[model samples]
Target: MYKISICVISFVFLFFLSVSLFTFSMNFLLNELTYFIEWEVVTLNSSSIVMTFLFDWISLMFMSFVLLISSLVIYYSKEYMAEDYNINRFIMLVLMFIMSMMLLIISPNLISILLGWDGLGLVSYCLVIYFQNVKSYNAGMLTALSNRIGDVALLLAIAWMLNYGGWNFIFYLELMKNDFDMMVIGALVMLAAMTKSAQIPFSSWLPAAMAAPTPVSALVHSSTLVTAGVYLLIRFNCLLENTWLGQFLLLFSGLTMFMAGLGANYEFDLKKIIALSTLSQLGLMMSILSMGFYKLAFFHLLTHALFKALLFMCAGAIIHNMKNSQDIRNMGNLVLQMPLTASCLNLANLALCGMPFLAGFYSKDLILEIVSLSYLNMFSFFLYFFSTGLTVCYSLRLVYYLMTGDFNSSSFMPLNDEGFVMLKGMMGLVIMAIIGGSILSWLIFPVPDMICLPSELKLLTLFVCLLGGISGYLISNVSLMFENKALNYYSMSNFIGTMWFLPIISTLGVINYPLKSGMMILKSFDQGWSEYFGGQMLYNSLKMNSSYNQLFQNNNLKIYLMSFIFWLIILTSLLII
Candidate 1:
């Protein structure tokens, strides 16, 4: 059973081989083992809709990493869900999510992508609501409905691509330069990617989605669901590089990063804070990709996956031991209790803060160096560095709260790391979270990017790290709201805390007024003028005509005699004429 849970031996072998293959294919055409296999699913008119898979190093490596993360999460879930009556159902849902993500990763065809995309959305909805509680139900609805926008956008892009006689977007992505139809398609695809990645207005669903089981959060937030959009946009880099939309996405994603970091500081829920961190990193990847540093984005994406998965695994272990209480305020100085899990959690947070020699440092530091060298306005520059600091701030704050203070929960309740099975699962990711950054930096880029900046500029990243660490450490231990006096300035604090009310504006603002207006429309139009004039007039006229027409067909004696006399007179008149 344990072997079955850690079912990634083949992928683990391929994971290492990907480095060789990527270098070989990238540097020399002679060693090119790239494969493109297509099956004609159906043909309509002059258009051929085919299911296509491209086996390049990128797809294989990403697929392997995804499977690897999922397997660990599954292994973790084995111990976590051991007592659940329907444990088999949970594993199957996770497997289905993995299969859907595999389809999404390998398929270059838009129609097939949509299939995988919709599968992800549907399966994720089920996973989010696995607890079958009201909170989970609401979260599942938000997750499903939010992803539906992306699904519809992808569908529209696929339909429009039919005019070009191919749903394989990879072929069109390069030729999309200034072509109006292709540009429209590109815009639609971008919108789909944005929604899937949870940028700005679509961001609320991500934190809500944490209502899912922790293992699901580990799998989804780490390597599969959220990364799908980033992966798609990376594949569509050709179109984005040439379009103004890239700049647009840069602005949106920057704000998203800043917003998420801010929200994490204000949040108390353990999983929600981590979820916001994921959002912030996602924004980082998207923003860098927008700036035409796709390789850099991919680098960060891979590294972030490593540490973030480990982080969630540790969080899960803690939550389980805490009897499923996820409020950080309920937890304090947990290091005195669950030392192993605390160590792992602290390592994950440090990596997230881009601490030196960790998995996050290689990718995150490179991203920052490149951004500083690029021609960015002061606003973007401020956003990038400030958001980076906020990441450290929240990460350190979380660490301090968990590692330093007195135990806030019941002292009698035993807290210990006795779950070796869970620890074994985390150990795999923990090793990666330590060394994965350096390994990926070496693998993905055979010829690494060169960055040379002045002393002050180079030190800026370090400076921000120091400053954020200081602030996070200095923060009052009474949680942000009470210590910061947020209750006194309630409205301002609430506004910032709730992601600038984008949730309310996006969910409630979208739902309430329109629904109220729709009710009014129903009353005024359906029950009033249209109903009276259209239905009543038509009904009366039809009823009267039907009454006259019914006499001829009623089989009544008088009606029969009248019809016979009328026909007889008509025949006689015709003969006389």
Candidate 2:
């Protein structure tokens, strides 16, 4: 009952606020209005310590989207975590997560953002480890440590910004383009965003963090934790635009997008596949921002959140019915058993693949067209297009497996779509997945993002999508019928399938040797020599001295007198002699 109350109260309040904010966002955009509310805490030595909040359509709409999704996810979690004893705790953590994201969204100061940023990292770690298992623990640690790297980068940026005698980066972003120290701050911010967004070299944590429950994945991966970096950079894009650091970001973001799409095709876990797609969309967002189109990046972020969350929820529903089996290979004929969930799953997958009229297409198609029009190198062009095809490929693969693939689970499996609680939660997003894009497109872009491209180039997006879909349908049939040849093409499969061994690299490669060295040092010094010579030596010396002192301390006067008499007799004998 408390769960229901918690969900209902929060859901109603947040959903209403989301609607109000969206209304306000439209008005703000039309009026070109922004409000800055600042409270001056103190002034010392020409530095002003202040708290600030910036309210514009961008921040407002983003906040609206976040709260909307968060409310639904909380409602969704009521049923998802019904059996767990610690569900109240889960609800609280998620609330904290949403608040942290709100803080991050509204803040323009580096000092202020850390409160939200660290809160996000801390709360996410709690969510990831909610199950309290070894796998969850490891994943939590990975998520925490990876985000900590970003935290450090942000701290460095703050330290560099100190030269300006203020912590608010909003005023300094443009100045960073000309000043070396300011540019250093920009570079640090870029690095921080990269780590936060789980770009290459920090990409493993996103997939690994699926150890968290599905609702957390739906929230954190879809819109909140993973999108924070892209949001930060979006606000700070003035510095990144036309800079060397931005160029570097572009390359890596492209690689991340490509890598995630390629990896998704090989992945089997339903949550992880969605997580990887989140990674791919993140890369797309980051890449577009690097090209100096922060608006598109932000637009995509909002739209992506809607469908991605839907995808995860549907996946959760499927996994819930499949007896918690996350392996896609174990799932088949799901469309018959769980029609509602399957339909939503395929819809979200289509949205992810940038199907026309879906939430994703409004942003994704525009982004690709923009990328095509930009004066990019051949390599960059290839990465953008190929990654798009891969997105369709993996998405189509999922659709086939869910819709038409043979029933691979046990014969006795009782899959059904009777979860009205879960379905009710998904209903809002299903509407959004279909109509959210058109609404957002109209609002975000008053006119339209008109692109003048050659016919061949114009048709390229559709062409690749079709080619990829055909290939994906064909590949799924061939691949599922045959045995997994992971062993035969060990090298290629291992490299591509394992996110290029990044999980091992991020978790093992980073810590393996240092942990081994720590163990060796622990054995040789602390356990061996230090134990023998330091603590043990002091212990033994103390024990022997304590024993000697015990003889007199035990009120042994007889022994003391006998010793004294013996000495006196010896002295007398010496004198007589």
Candidate 3:
């Protein structure tokens, strides 16, 4: 009830904001409007810190979408978390997360955004560990620690901005676009965004965070948390255009997309597969931003949120009915038992694959077309096309296993869409996923993005779709036994299947050796030679000194006389010398 009321308030607020902005855009053309509420200023140093908010098409539209999705997710949670004892606490944490995201969306200042940045990290850690299990605990730790990297990076960026004489770094982006100091700031911000966005070395945490509740997963993976990095880059896009670090982002983001898409095809866990898909989409966003298409990247970001949240909700329904079993191998012919869920799932999957007329098709197809027109080198070309194809391939593969096979669950298990609250939550998103892309495409871009290419190049997307579909069908239904066996083999399968051992590398490879070395050092130095020389050696010397002092104090005349004679002999020898 509290959730529903809060969501309503948020939805109405964003609704009026959208309407007002749309009306304003019709009368006058404003590039940007910034408002600052002064918080403090140091008189002696002439420095000031203020709460600055930037309202533009990007922030308003993005905020509307965030609020819409969050509202739906909260409504969906009513039934999903009905049995939990701490439902109020859960709702509070979620609302706090939404507030953080709101702060992030509005603010343009480096120091101000940190408030939202740290808020996201801390709240997400709480959400990940909501279950209080070992897996959840571990996932929470990884999520918090990985995001800590971004926090530290942001702090460094704030420090770097001090040299520019102010904390409102957003104001300086254009003035210092090509300067060395701005370049350094851009690099640090990019690094921070990558950690928050889970790029490369930080990629393992996003998947691990699936240990969280499904609603949290839907929100975090879809909009609020993971997109922080992409949004950060979008804000800094002006500074990054044509820079060497932009080229590096293009290369690595492409790799991340490819890696995640490949990893998705090999994953069997239902939520994990979706999480990896989210990673792939993030890579796509980052890569496009690197290529200087900030608007296009943001367009895709909004549309992806709609469909991806629906996809996760539908998945949540299936998981709830399936007795919490998330393995796709254990699920089959679910469409017959749960028709509405299957329909929603199919729609979401189609949108993900860029099916014509769906939400993903408008933004995704345009992105690919634009990428095609760009003057990319051979490697970049391969990465772009292949990653796009991989999206279709894994999506088709998922549908085949879950929708086509015979029912594999126990006879006593009844699967049905009894979770109406969940389905109700999905309804609005379903409509959006079907038409949101087309509508946003019409509303957002004043002029259609230009794509000049050969006929063959223009049809590349269709060709890849055909190839990926065929490949997916063959692998899912008619692949050779030997091929399947090879995939299950220990060495070959493990490398590709476990995401090139990134999980192991991020965890064991990172910590194991360093921890072992520390233990060895503690034993060899702190406990061995240092202890013997500092503690035991000092104690023995102190005892010997005390014993010699007692001997000198002995009340024996013979001892005293012997000592005196020794001193006299020493004096005679010195005199002779």
TM-score of each: 0.86, 0.90, 0.89
Which numbered prediction scores highest in TM-score against the true structure? 2
Query: How many clashes show up per model?
Result: 0, 0, 0
Please tell me which predicted candidate would have the highest lDDT against the true structure.
2
The residue pairs found clashing in candidate 1 are none
| Alpha-carbon lDDT of model 3 | 0.87
lDDT of each: 0.86, 0.90, 0.87
Residues 1-577, candidate 1, lDDT per residue (tens digit)? Answer: 5433333443344345545544444443334467889888788997766678987767877876787787678777778888777877787788789889889988988978998999999999999999999999999999999899999999999899888888877787676656888878878988999889999989999999999999999989989999999999898887777469888899999999999998888888999999999999999999999998888898898889999999999999999998999988889888989999999999999999999999999998999999999988898899899999999999998987787778888878689999997999999889999999887777676587778899999999999989988877765444554654665656655877799898887788889998999999999899989999999889999999998888667879998888899999999999999
In candidate 3, what are the lDDT values of residues 126-162, reduced to their tens digit? 9999999999999999899888988998999999999
Candidates sorted on TM-score, descending = 2, 3, 1
Native RMSD of candidate 2 (Å)? 4.5
- Output the lDDT of residue 226, model 3: 97
TM-score of 3: 0.89
